[model samples]
Target: MAFKFGSFDSICGQGALPVCPLLGTSQGIEPGCYSRNVDLGGTIIFQPGACFIHIIALIMTLIMVLHIRSKYTAVGRKEIALFFYVYAVIELLCLFLDSGIIPTAHVVYPWFTAVHVGFICSIFWILLANGFVGFQFAEDGTPMSLWSLRISAFVVWGVSFFVAIATFNGYASFSYTKPMGLFIVLLVFPIVCVAIYVVSQLILVIRTLDDRWVIGDILFGVGFFTVGAVVLFAFSVTVCDAVEHYIDGLFFFVLCMLLSVMMVYKYWDSITKEDLEFAVGDKGAVWEVKECVVPSSFPPSRLASLPPRLRVFEVVALYLLTRSVSLPPSLSVPCSHLRTPTSRRRTTSLRTEEPEDLSSEEWEETSTTAPNLLEETTEATLPRDRVKATEARAASKGSTTRTHRREVFGTKKERESLLGRIGFSFFDASLPLSFFL
Candidate 1:
């Protein structure tokens, strides 16, 4: 049967109201009515709001294509760029179909059917490309499983497209009728894929402490799409009628436009001025500091090697890794060096040389022995030997004085709290909670 907008109003007549679908056909007239809209090439074409959403989608696809082509040179990124170009082409075609620029039917019926099916396939391709891009950028590295994900999304969309076409042609039937069934499949599949990508992205952000710009962009896009999808799904299921459908379509359109603008702004510099390298370089520096400040990777056995006071600092360092803002370049370099095998061996050796307890006699002996040890070690043999010697001498003097003070007048927890205060202020200034949301 042909669908017409405002059909429900006509059926109700002037003074009468439409019955509620949820309250049963026998129930009194309800205040709201469903709109009658025809599905053309798998898109609802009667609603201007949906048309607007399609236009916004096309703009976003174009921006992504240009951004990737200009800023990224990696082999994997080039492949992603190609996918985006194809996505843009298909989206533009779908927009034309919805706009009636392309005729809905032809003398050869199968030709029309093929065009309709192609439209649905194109939408799926765009979604697949979007998911791939999110996954690629969120990881802050090349996707190792790029080929696998691409192949999987392609297979799913191909199968779903043919199934939708067959249903439209009456060759197949399902419990919910073919068109609705196809809609449900298409809607649910992408939602599932996007959800997985978002969760993976969240984990990557937490673990690596990457910049929020990339994470925030993906979250906003996915969040809007998800809300829009839920509303549309409810409308399609007959839980809500035509008016609800139109309202939801309007909301979706507005959200899509907002998402498009967000994407553009987030990548504007990288896209226009070829500054992705600089942005990535800054992110790398933060990631390096994050790795250094957290010693979670260290075994519990290693903690015993450090002096009691230094052990407390290690604990402080761990806490800072979790909450500190902007790790200094100085700390990052030493932390990286310490993680190396040779550097680790040297640390172990130094710990072995440290006395269990520092007495005045022990301090003098250690201080005299350090100079002699320095002379014995060749320049090549101990690249960091001089620095280590200087630091060790300072630590020895400090520990000896502190120990004497404690023995003479009972010690109190007199450790300076500057690091904690500095960490708090730095974190507050650099990352406000508003940025995360």
Candidate 2:
């Protein structure tokens, strides 16, 4: 069998150069010797080798689409996934067209072939757009970028489809004999898109990426694409004759194209990294929040050893423990008392009281009696005078034992310091504390 390039209707029967199977406007392979035509009832299936490969290619394209979708944070992920989706559709049509599942003699074959050609052209245009996506020409995954890619691809596909349909149906100037428009749309246009895409991606990899190995993927992809094209168009006849029609360029071409597409995915994946901080993944956002640790006597190394939840609690506890206790502003302690440690103890003693057994209501009443207590200490009194007044009050109340204990230990006799208030034995006063602001 031989290959022909003109129109689907003009495809001649088998003699020397068998007419192309895909609408005759595009390049297609004839049935090889190894192609076993199966008869499922009355229908004859042709080109099993090419059909199987097309199926494999379609499966690979779908897998690549899924792979592209998985990289949610990758730059141009949405656009590139769209590219694979289009390619998968193209491969699906190729399966029907190239495999002879949809025979050229069928009326719908021309329409499917035209649409296939259009998709091939459009998918390449989308690839060129993807190259610019890495440069951040527009914010990727945004409506502007996605819509522009979609609309432009649609236009490319529409124009290519028109040319193919016109050529196949012999409408307008696109004759079946000379399909110059179809040639440009199906062949030359894709070459241009591929060339531009490769150049732009090379620039991106060189300028933006640190690892130069990613360039190898691009090179490999280009090489595979070139080889696939050369095999399909230039060496198809040679290979067919050499193998005695057991196999043809179509098989090698599909395999090579699959490898090329895989390489494209690898190249894209290598160049783009996921923006995990911003991009919402399938697992959703996993915010790792930690309380801001202020500088303190506890070194960061030690603090880091504690659980994240406990770090904040320990910091607060340490803050209250280390700070010096002071009188309330309303109490009006004398300046002299604040100046000396001994004077501070004496002044604190005047305000301090024993932690006696009291009901919750009594404690609340005592805590709320701020005005009466303030009035009692309006004027500054000597420490000796205050001690005498306290002792006399205690003697009258018949609590001389409590008053004696207060005089010995000052204000701290019955009061638990802030350190004890936390009720954790982890704190050690002997440990060295360092503070950082």
Candidate 3:
């Protein structure tokens, strides 16, 4: 069929060039090819979709470069560093070709076609590096595994480079030709590397379920990148044409931007507010009252040094006490110890013996018999001692009061203040105070 403007053949067969089946089948291929033809004087001569993809990839390259430059001194793997350097150079070259600054048709420029393919495949290598780096950081904030992946990715890209050179020189081209080389090196290798990296990261995250935010961030970043890569791959294949190509590129760009933002947010959120405030050297005043609250079986001091598991039990007991007047089952003890029958019998016998031993006149004269008079004489003779005793008792009471206040009120208040500053108010302050009382 003769070529038409919007028809697949017409767009792919611009500039009076022979129609290639590979080019013809690729979707979203038309706009880029058509645009390139218009740029090269109304005839399609080069693959526009491929050129556009490279240009976008070059932009991504610049972003990666800037990110690396911003964090150059950050401890990471050497292989990742090399990948960044090589990927940057390749992307720059691809940008030049896509911009049409490097003419491939000239015999003097016989290697330009091979160079273009090599650079195109290198974009995937960079993406793989990025994903691997993310996975490394997510697991332990280290980059050791990224280095290994980078080395493997480079080997894969190297093989594609030789294939690109051979194919462009009109050497034996198999059903697995330039595109296959590009797919294996750029698309397939990177996808596999990222998949492995992401899965490993997820396993680590699941194992360390203590940090939900980290897991969420990893999932967000990897999921976005995976979807974007899939869309880009579809564009690279013939399933998507000109308009779809631009759409895919835009989608990929958005996903990348979202991933970057998520990484930043996750890093900042990981730092607790107390740490942040301490870093700023802010020690604000705390308003609180303390009470003398002790554990049923042990002194409050004993509870402080208990192991984490025991501490958790103590906290639960305290919470239950605060919520209810009845002592928890864990604290319940027999009433016999509180009011012993033996002690009650001893008290009764003493009262009976004391009544028979005392006559009213002798009891009045005897120190033990006239209990009220004995108490009066003792008080009258030791007035100064009483004052000193009162002062000592007051001081001791004050110290005990402060200790109880801290145990009952200070900790909860401090925690509430912290949570409030961080914008979390799920637990009401009154609940803990009631428990302490």
Q: Give the winner by lDDT.
A: 2
Per-residue lDDT tens digits of candidate 3, residues 1-437? Answer: 35333233433333211112233343213332222232566544344544466556556656655554344234332434455566556546544544445554445343654554565456455544544443344442245465555566666556666765554354566232234443454445655756665675566556644676676666676667766554433332233355543232323433453453344234323421223332322355642212212223332233333343334433443434434544445433221111112222211000111232223443223222212222323333242443344345446767554443333223443423322222222123233222221
Q: Backbone clash tally for model 2?
A: 7
Ordered from best to worst lDDT, the candidate numbers read 2, 1, 3
lDDT (C-alpha) at residue 122 in model 2: 94
Per-residue alpha-carbon lDDT of candidate 1 for residues 342-400, written as tens digits (9 for 90 to 100): 22222211111222334335333433442343343334223244334444555676766
Clashing pairs in 1: 34-242, 35-242
Give all TM-scores, in the order shown: 0.41, 0.62, 0.39
Model 2 C-alpha lDDT per residue in residues 174-209, reported as the tens digit of each score: 765576677678767888989999999888877877
Cα-based lDDT at residue 54, candidate 2? 74
Which TM-score value belongs to model 1?
0.41
Which 10 consecutive positions of candidate 1 have the poorest summed lDDT? Answer: 14-23
Rank ordering of all candidates by TM-score, starting from the highest: 2, 1, 3
Each model's lDDT comes to 0.41, 0.61, 0.41
**Residue 391 displacement (Å), model 2:** 39
Residue 353 alpha-carbon offset, candidate 3, angstroms: 81
Evaluate residue 246 in candidate 1 and report its C-alpha lDDT on the 0 to 100 scale: 48
lDDT of 2: 0.61
